[model samples]
Target: MEKPWTKSVTLALEGPGKYVTISNTTEASWAMIEDWPLDDAPALNRALDICAAAVEGKRPAEDARKAFIEAAVEADIEIRE
Candidate 1:
């Protein structure tokens, strides 16, 4: 017997000032979103929204990636993953 393949989304926001990362990958890791600052609201919300749209199949992964990059650029935030 073999294990079935599965996918999942991992959202994590570390210490203050760190840009939240939304990693879409196989079910290999799990994380929780917590301790986010109020100032990071807009960008964080947008990221979550984009992730939601992508997971729901409302948008292609590439399109979502582009959107994420665009939003990050607009906010002057650097994406590391």
Candidate 2:
């Protein structure tokens, strides 16, 4: 099934590194904002890997969120002040 929001999301996250603006209108999706490193470092790779894994259904969304949150914290990126 094609998802409109997902298409929007692909466009939103199209760059190698960019700000993530998440907004969910469905039960399985939620909103978040993440600033990614433009250097294409390990952190960025990890973030993209996690997102791709989640989107491909290789991992659950909650799990992906947890991974991303952990990564963000490790990277010293403050979220949800």
Candidate 3:
């Protein structure tokens, strides 16, 4: 029951040149669990939980999106507008 966010979040995955666009809870979760560079962090854990909740239909996808952004910031990842 994964849900898509109203807007997508773009992150610079391999520095400023490369990027990944996450548009839904599932993508966010995958990015956090599989592609994230940091081993662990408070914001990363929070984002994982929120993404799970969003996929389970217990929370809005936008919540997961916000959490993902926070996690990205915590990991020193660049967020593109």
What lDDT would candidate 1 get against the real structure?
0.42
lDDT for 52 in candidate 3 is 88
Candidate 2 or 1, higher TM-score: 2
Compare candidates 2 and 3 on lDDT and give the better one: 3
> What TM-score would you give candidate 2 relative to the actual structure?
0.46
lDDT of each: 0.42, 0.44, 0.87
State the local distance difference test value for candidate 2: 0.44
* lDDT (Cα, tens digit) per residue for candidate 1, span 1-81: 212223222223454355455544111112213333333546545655665676676755555455444544454444453
| TM-score, ranked from best to worst | 3, 2, 1
Candidate 1 minimal-lDDT segment of 10 residues: 25-34
Model 2 / residue 34 / CA error / Å: 9.0
Which residue pairs clash in candidate 3?
none
lDDT score of residue 45 within candidate 2: 57
Top-TM-score candidate index: 3
Q: Which parts of model 3 have CA positions greater than 4 angstroms off?
A: none
1-81, model 3: which lDDT tens digit per residue? 444689999999766769989888888888888889997899999999998887787888888899999999999999989
User: Candidate 1: deviation at residue 38, Å?
Assistant: 8.9
